[model samples]
Target chain A: MNTLIFRTIAPFLAALMLVFSVFVLLRGHNEPGGGFIGGLIAASAFAIQGLAQGVSAVRRALKMDPLGIAAIGLLLSALAGFLPFLGAMPFMTGLWIDLNLVADTVPVSSVMLFDIGVYLVVAGTVTAIALALEEKETD
Target chain B: MASTAAVSPALLEQAMSIAPVPPEHWLIVAPVLVPLAGGAALIALRHRPGAGRALVGRLSILLLALTLAANIGLFLMVVEKGALTMVMGRWLPPFGIAFTADRLGAAFSLSAAAIALLAAIFTRGEAGTGAPAYGPEPFHLLLLAGVSGAFLTGDIFNLYVWFEVLLIASFGLLALGPDRAELDGALKYGFLNLAGTTLFLVAVGLVYGVTGTLNMADLAMRLPAMEGVPAVTLAALFLFAFSMKAAAFPVQFWLPAAYHTPRASTAALFAALLTKVGVYAMLRVLVMLMPAPLEELSLLIAAIAAATMLFGGLGVLAERDLRRLPGFVLISGIGTMLAGIALHSPGGATGAIFYGLQSMALMLALYLALFEAARLAGTPDLMKGGGLYARHPLFSGLVLALFFAAAGLPPFSGFWPKALIVKAALDIGAWWLAGAVLLSGFFLTVGLARAYMLAFWHPQRPPAPVGRGPQTGQAALSARPQKLALTTILPLAVAALAVIGFGLFPERLLQLSGDAASGLADPAAYVGSVFPGAKP
Candidate 1:
């Protein structure tokens, strides 16, 4: 499957795809983008690499296991719920921060961060579990 | 611990004084944190595979043991201290995390914890052999997280979040046993329940819109002050949402189709807790927090409850699959409990509480017993068993007792709760309703008897015996003992004893639940328990 042209291009493209997925995840809270879409993009990147090289190749490329990513994302989201507890508020009340940027207000919040964590989790968990099951079917 | 998380003065003022702040809330909370922390630690230590899995298992067992012990401790504390409530982070009443420990909550928690503990033990036993390897601790941890979250969360929105927690964890559990049939169940379970959850979320949003506060105590406080437009709408949303969760009437197909596929222990655990969480939330928010909703649409709910009971009981009678029968019976019992709740009188409501507790314990006990019998008898095919009463006498005896408990036979806890529900309904001038409630018990008993007759006494056409017939055990290849290990034996024993003991000793539970019902009826008591300094 790894023809000469595909072999050279796959890694570069997958890495680019993953980085772009993070961008979507980070921007999810304010704009239309977020973790779910981001995770799907990242998974797509691995799929592309899988197509060009092999399943094992994609699995190796993503070192952090998908299940772990999903779990951490879940924890990060839950921790977001607990953030208020730390700030002497009730559980799950949203917290915000603002940075005086050159053009925009550049608002940031723990919720948005939590979404990013969710994004990584969704991306990692779905892809890993799906791919792992597919490999099992083959066996 | 005193740095910044003090309960605000204004919030305390809102919670009028009467109830003592329940210290036992920490006992429940500690078991919950252990798994949450363990999940985090396991992820951090993922590089050490052996250590991680071992830690997860050991910690889960240890945590479950501790939680069981915690329930025991909390039970003692409840007897000593009355109902209990805990406010997380010491925020003011409306702004903090509230966890309560009334007798009702303790009863449910103790039952659920017992189920989880048994499931943990069974999983451990299965792990050593060639059976399906249990999923990582995070899965069970997430499962427990959902259970604890459901048990402890005091607000509506937080309940939604806990629903999501369990939803995600359920995805893992469903997928862990992935196959064509399992996936079929998973997809249906996910889509349907997610819809129920989303419906609940919408209601919470609407309740917040109407009440402007998500806190149960705050809602109770504001409910009296608020006007109509959205209150009825909020109530409607709550009914629709909780009905779906409890699998009331029309929305229950997802349960029977999906539940039988999981590993037996997992199925039993889900059987014990999932729908009850819905009941608990409904009891918390609708009955206690906003009394008007419980009274207003109760007749409609009663009708739905009646339908749920009849359909479920009949559904169980029709099923030949042994595992599937109990699933239907479990669904049927939901209707019975709802009937108790629907009578809309205090007596009726308390009856619902007792029956709800009794049935949950009995249904779980039934599943464990049935699973054992099915494995021993093999084929679980109702048509093919004969004289097993002579072969597996002890197992048969347990099955008979569980059937009696499930059927509400006298001297069993199930009977008293069943009797109370009827009495409660009758006290409310709903003689017809009382009759239906009584009939539900009798109907379920009929199904139980049918299953018993077919399972042990019915003579097979071929007259199969040990020497002449086909295989009649879990493994057709061999007559494996289908070992009833300590884990299996212990939880079942506890449930049986609870059924018999709680049945005869109804007065204690009644007294306990009366204090709880009083505390729950007055939301102020719940609020005051969390903030002892608050005055009426």
Candidate 2:
């Protein structure tokens, strides 16, 4: 039942999708891209891997429980939101830290961190579902 | 596209120049945020089972205690300072999400946390998240977060979000223990509640469309000047949605069918907190936000209240299963609250608030008592065994107290609120409503008394004549503590004590509930606090 072509190209396609997901995640703060979209892309990469190899293969590749990853993402986002409390601001207030990198000064915001957390949560949740479905179908 | 439109540059500039509001009050968000953070942390540790179970249980208790303390402090602050409003990320009212801690919201939040804390402690004793198959901590914490959010939110859309959070947690909790019947119950519970929430979303959308605002305070100000029909329809929609959630009349079939399927502790927590949140939302939105429409529909609401009470009382009479009887009792309690709402008097509303709190305590105590009684009787069916009064006087006493309190007997916590509601009904000249309340209480008492006779007083063996003790062996009081004594009996005793305490000193509760009712009756303070310069 294995397709040779799908097995051959799955890893490369997954790599490309993973990289593109990060691109979408990074620009989500000010642009149209977002954690949700980025996570979908990453989840699609895992879905492809699960399809090409198996559910077990995808689990081995992730090296962490999907639900656990989702939990971490949720915690990260909450921590990002709570960071403003230290500054005596309301919850979910955006905080920025400017980093100087040799020739350039870059600004990083907690909003972006929250976006990343969302991305991880979305990816983890969707991938978990996909793997479960695939595993169930096989059984 | 043809560029023929003349756009206003000033409008664009005005929109661009609006700055986000600076954060002024940091403490306002603690009710929702604390539980969210705790839930996340608990989920993170979900995979590691049993090893750190005790530590996690302690941490959960500590976290809930902190939340309760913080909520009580916030409630006091709100009462002292009017309303505490926080606009998320400094956005102004009607634009950014608003979290307001008014008298009603704060009191409900505090009570919710208190119930959750006690439930958590009781659950820990039963078998905390330490048990692999029972009591997932994250869901419980998330459910608390959602309930807190529902009370604290000042925006309707945000309330929907919080409902989802709680609903998801509840679904997990509902299906937690192993019972094949639970699947059927969970399905019904899930679908009906989902339909209710869906209706709520549609109502929210309609309300937003008409008033151009989702903020509760802003809507209160804007809604009156708008057309009446849509507002009334929206009110009806809210009534349907919230009434379904509260499991009142006609729509209440789901409660008895499903509530008893969960583990006893889980059912107790659900019985205590879930429907009350729905009733709280109804009191907040339907009565406070849309008072005119509710008044217009008072006769219809009163009719429904009567029917709900009748149906619930009949169900209790018809039920033979001991565990399922409390579910009907819960439905009957919902009807009593609805009857108060139907009266639309300040007295009626105050009675409703007081009754809501009393029901929260009594329902938990009743379910926990059922667990103890069943443990002693060796069956969930009351007809199978008897003479609990002779064998286990302490537990039988607890059950009697809870039953009397629930039946609205004199000098118990339930009596004062029922009296207030009855008086309010008579004052409003809704004699039928008053009759229904009394009749329902009568039926509840009769039914419970019969159950008590069958389960506790009547023995399979013939009773000894006159004042002699039964020959079912001596009343043995073991020096050693029995199993589940700490886990089960302690919480039930505490709840019984609270009921007694509420009865002894009803002043503080009455005063607080009166203040909450006053706030609900008049949204002026709430509106003014939210919109500083808006004309009434």
Candidate 3:
């Protein structure tokens, strides 16, 4: 499982998957992909890196504890739900803001923020579990 | 296109009927959201050096206090305004997730929050300064959130989600200890509860398939009118699933086996709140949502209730472990509440709700008392322990009061609910149910008296040299008296006061319980609250 070819390609594969995950997360507002699926993809990427470079390397790369990341994601999602309170609206109400860029308009919404939070939560939790399992294997 | 046209008029009417929510309505959700947000924040701070156990415990206490206040406010508002409903994201009923608070939900949520706050304070005395990576505070808050959500949610599917939330948190709390017994207990608890909730989910799916709505109020309205929908079978499935969760009758094996394995604070919280939530769900569904099926199945439920009462009482008498005794007491109390449900009258429902509330506080206090008693004696074994009153008279008195309450003796909180239930049973000509209730109470008293005599009154005897091991001798010798902490004493005192207060002057609770029962017996206001202009 730890062959030279596999080890060499894993980092690049993980990087590509992480990028693809973000793409899926961003496009989820009006498309087939969303935070849950994106998070799964990112979690798989972390698992791949853990398998290739070891759990310690992945932990060091993340710089934050995976559970901390999950916690922050939960906070972000909850805050997103609270955003409508400023406008005297009920909880979890979506408020959209369209950004006028140099060449195009990009629409951002609290719903999108919520999706990103969900993605981070899923990715972080899965990575934490996977890393723990992998470390147990090494032990 | 034809279908769209066909649905457009009703959709438009529903959309137009959506009213702007008042600012005060947020209180209904605050009990749930505050804990979730606080829990997440606590977890986020888990790795920080400054976030020690003391800090986390204080934060948890503050958070739970806030939730309890919110619940009280919500309860008051519901009492004043009748049932209150808040649909998420301004969606109409039958499509949106609804948080509806009637007398029963509001009162139960208030009790849940109060018990949670007390449990949080109890944990402060037990928590050490060294903080684990995942402390119990966050999970505690998350568990409260789940419970409050379960109590308040009007959507059946949302209730399932809340159950899962609490179940996950409970599993985390159950396995937090390093002992193998904790893990073993958690496995059994987790497996049985998961099976219960899975059945519940399947039933919910079938309900939606049949009735085409997950909103409880809408189901209540539609279920009776719908013909050839197997409503009785669906009701039976619901009762079976909830009965499993409630640890009633034959399905109750998991509770006593697992509840005693957790640390005392966690165990007390579970004893106080978990099965009560199951009972609350049962009452809400069977009584309010599907009355016809409940009437049809009253006999079966009564049989189950009687068996649960007898078995739980007998288990209490035969149990040796002090920690496990409270679990059986809890099960026995649940049986009494089920008898109330079986009576299927407003009086019966009132008795059930009142008994449930009393049991929640009593069970929490009882478990905490047992934990302290075990610590004082240096062992949890009933036969090996004695002479608690000789050392801590005040504490022993408190434990006695809680036991009397558990036994449904006179001049305690437990007596009033028993009287209410027995009277309701007699009124309905359920002589056997009334007999079961009285007989179970007697059994419980005897069981508890034997426990109290062995653990608190009887003189501590020297260990027998021949059969008793040296470890037992050492344990008895090493029983150094420890001073009870103020944090521990305060919660126990508050619980005792509540039991006595409610016992002496039960008129208020009786009236509140009666209102809750009436609301269940006729859910016109409950449905009307959810859909403002909908016909009952």
In terms of lDDT, which candidate is strongest? 3
Give one digit per residue, the lDDT tens place, for model 3 in B354-435.
9999888898899999977877776677888788889889999999999999999989999998898899899978999999
Deviation in angstroms for B356 in model 3?
0.9
Candidate 3 segments whose C-alpha is farther than 4 A from its true place: B1-13, B16-18, B127-131, B463-481
Estimate, for each residue in B80-199, the C-alpha lDDT of model 1 and write its tens digit: 776566565444457666766666666667766676776666565443221223454456666766767676666768778888887777777776663566678789888898899898
- Please give the DockQ score of every candidate, comma-separated: 0.15, 0.44, 0.55
For candidate 2, what TM-score does chain B get against the true chain B? 0.90
Per-candidate fnat, comma-separated:
0.12, 0.59, 0.57
Candidate 1 segments exceeding 4 Å error: A1-53, A72-123, A126-139, B1-28, B39-58, B71-103, B126-138, B459-483, B529-536
Per-model TM-score, in order, reads 0.81, 0.91, 0.95
Which prediction has more favorable TM-score, 1 or 2? 2
Worst 10 residues of 1 chain B by lDDT: B125-134
Best by DockQ: 3
The CA lDDT at B417 in model 1 is 60
Q: Is candidate 2 or candidate 3 better by DockQ?
A: 3
Sorted by lDDT, highest first, which candidate order results?
3, 2, 1
- For model 1 the local lDDT of residue B344 reads 65
Please give, for residues A1-139, the per-residue lDDT of candidate 2 as tens digits: 4689989999999999999999999977778899999999999999998988999989998987787788788888988888876776667767787799999988888888888889988998899889999999889
